[model samples]
Target: MSTSLAWESNHGKDPDVLIIGAGISGICTAINLLRHTPIRNFLLLEKGSQIGGTWNDNQYPGCCCDVWSHLYSLSFEPNPSWSREYPGQEEIHAYLKRVCQKWGLYSFIQFNSVVEDARWDGETLKWCSKVRVTGGKSEEFAKEGYVIKSDYLVSAVGQLNMPYYPDIPGLGEFKGTVMHSARWDWSKRIEGLNVGIIGNGATAAQIVPEVAKTAKTLTVFQRTPNWLVPRDDKKISGMRQALYRYLPPIRRRYRASLMDFRESWYDAAVVEDSDLNNTMRDLCAELMTKQLVDKPELVAKLTPNYPPGCKRIIISDDYYPALNRQNVELNTGTIEKTTETGIVVEGKEIKLDVLILATGFKTVQFMYPIKIYGENGRSLEDIWPSGARAYLGITVESLPNFSMLYGPNTNLGHNSIILMIEAQSRYITEMISQVHHARSNGHTLSITPSNCTVETFNEEIQERLQKSTFASDNCNSWYKNEDGVITNNWCGNVIEYQNRVSAINWKEYEITGSCAETLLKKDKSRLGRVVEESNSALIPIAGVVSMAALGVAAYLVRYGPRRIR
Candidate 1:
């Protein structure tokens, strides 16, 4: 075992909550805990030394969020000073850091500590987690393994962190610098080197455009071409930035406009063979044709055979133009194997100084490589033999007191994920509040979504997904599992999902414990307290104004200009 500070840390000391990753989801969860709940004994475990999960890991050239900056950020903490309409990786990472610092979350985060496994201890009524501390050179068990306990567990480890490299034969024997786009090697100079990149999804699309500018020769192996949409990314004007900083109403109006525009494409995502889908397909084709006007041969190879939303629509203004470069060659031939010098494509050896695997992540493998033992020692892998499912993509049956953010079936095809994360965070905080209230009243509450409830929800969503464009067999995408079930996406619009996860129904859960009645009473008491506290804050203002005038003022504060701020 490697070094771990098991003895030094507060290991075995039970916290209120244990969050797995330090990504945007994890940060949002922690912020919610700090703002909305009274529970302070919580910890965040991050395998890496830094935060910003995907943003920190990906630093490749031309890498930026496809979602616009204003809409991609948290609703409570908007960044009015974005350098571009779409901020790059460094800026996003810095934004996360600033949020964490503002909330004083660094003290609660244990860096370089990876969670090995989490087990539900039935006797203790708590989760016993096994953690492994990395970065220490010494091979000592005391410094390697640690145990911590928490009443609740949160899996905030997002989908894209794990890099997927194809098991091409003789890949290990290739005498070249091999890397994945997710794990870019900045040290290896590609200024004049021949580079061969495999896969042509979103990551490859971004990588190729930038690499073509510097590489002596670039070969992009396309398994399937994705629909290219013009990004039209531009720098935000100074006047707009100043207005957003000074006028809250203007900032909110702009955010709403961007949000509405993104939502308008939801019809194209879900309804296959509809007018919206056809119109989008035609527009993407026209855009592709405009970019490759000079090279007719490259146009066909770059065009997608699948529907626009079947695979993710690539957002780039330069990817099509980069494919027309004289030094760049698009190879659609099947790769036979990797030779000692280069990759064999249709029996021809294409020599390369570097080989890059741009294959996407294991999207279906939710809570992957981590053994999550639910009630009676049932593993998560055994439960999701076909694919992962959850009631509202948050809670699962048999996995009591465990919740996930950005989990299965919650990924959106038409909108920003930050919105989803906020919704999920609020829902998780509500559940945490429930557990806290119950436990304080001497009840050992174990909550799992009723199996029937989860099944019904998954069945309805999967059925709708079958009618969606992602069900098209034209391309093999990472969105589906081995069973061809679309486990990575929400089959409806973002507004629908926002409404679904906003509140939790008590009847939907299977609650246990001898003190269940007492817990219910406490739940009502908590609700009453919230109402009374809200009314108490309005008393002083109520004293100076007439009843009708006070009511009007209160309504204005709730839904007017003050609401925007």
Candidate 2:
């Protein structure tokens, strides 16, 4: 057992796996590799100085997960002591930190080490990642930039990390304190000051109510209104927490119930005119009407013209009521431009002390700014001319031994994304297992999904997505790229995706440098052991029975109906 960071110096050998980003997907993939596979020699390079990826970045006021607290967490490591139905940013970040500590993952992580580029070395059959050690605690490294080689490269750098600032005419000239919602400055004071927040997406919905309580005047500039569903958030009682902690079965069942309820909304998300979609739209409309009954004029401004699930649906109980506050004014006018003092809305100046751009993230750019090269030094940018696509949102066509978690077409509209992350991690680990087995037999293996397989899979995904609400003609969302390609969201439910990737079809992948003879001999040796252990008369019968039983058990373990976890 080698020390984590000292592997480079002590062993003088490349790690088996190198994962980028220490966010939810990255951490989950690392944990899966540790728990499930014998490939323990792995490292995680995080650009930030912390483990929690998005949770570490976005620390804005009223920032919390829209999904249920129980469902948002890892299935293997459930937290029974959630304070509320939805966990806040601080709590989520703390949970991730605790999980990392519990798994002893800190030693394996190199903070502030930005991955500049990763190129596949065809001759060596490995990935060479160019890493820049940025100034921080990570400056302990002697050199500024260095190369780290690995047998496999897993990109867990999620889509939501990079903040997207809209191309406003004078956004750079804003004299007052300007901030993106993802990079909120906690030190900046908001009390008794006039604050103007641009964009009314999910982040804006969460920020509006909290800012309205403190700010003297809060102006929300909405380009378009999002369908706001009632969060119905509630604090967990002490007794309930005790029950969840003490009785593990109850907690597991509760999480299952949440998953089931969330999965039931898949039709609403995919089908534009589905009955469930209509029901969901009605529920959101009713919530908006009930919350803003006293302010009908504001209701007209807040109502969305697009389909319910066309854009990301926001879950907030306070957003509609917050708009009714005297200090809060919802502006639906066209923003002409911005000056040093304030923004010009409908050719009128609305002076503001603070300007907050709650403009979300670059969701379509899967792994941008990081130059990734595949076979023949073909760049990832060149491969994805239109947008990113993967065989199952995991393995690419030409990128051998490369996998991505939360890649293109994997984002969910109704259910938790943690489920998808787990599936991808498991699939990637299985691929790594094949490599490990081959290497153990004195042979190196390079695995890449065939071009035909990736193309067919993407074609099916896009064809299905065209019928979904995400690609609806009425609305444009972050889910689609500049080319109008739906690149961010999965077209099917969580269970469907899980079932699709639950097992690896080796036929779909092009495997090279595999030790066929050695692997075959090993299988034969196992069969010989089973035969030798049986009696001479019953040897044939016993061997067949044992193999049949093993096959059945494996099938049940993989595909049978079982607990949600």
Tell me the alpha-carbon RMSD of every candidate. Answer: 9.4, 10.3
Runs with alpha carbons beyond 4 Å of true place in candidate 2: 1-7, 514-565
Model 1, residue 61: displacement in angstroms? Answer: 1.4
In angstroms, give how far residue 496 of model 2 lies from its true place. Answer: 0.6
User: Which residue runs of candidate 1 sit more than 4 Å off their true CA positions?
Assistant: 1-12, 136-142, 519-565
Report the Cα lDDT for candidate 2: 0.82
lDDT by residue (tens digit), candidate 2, 331-375: 999998989999998889999999999999988878877889999
Pick the lDDT winner. Answer: 2
lDDT of 1: 0.79
- After superposing all C-alphas onto the true structure, candidate 1 shows an RMSD in angstroms of 9.4
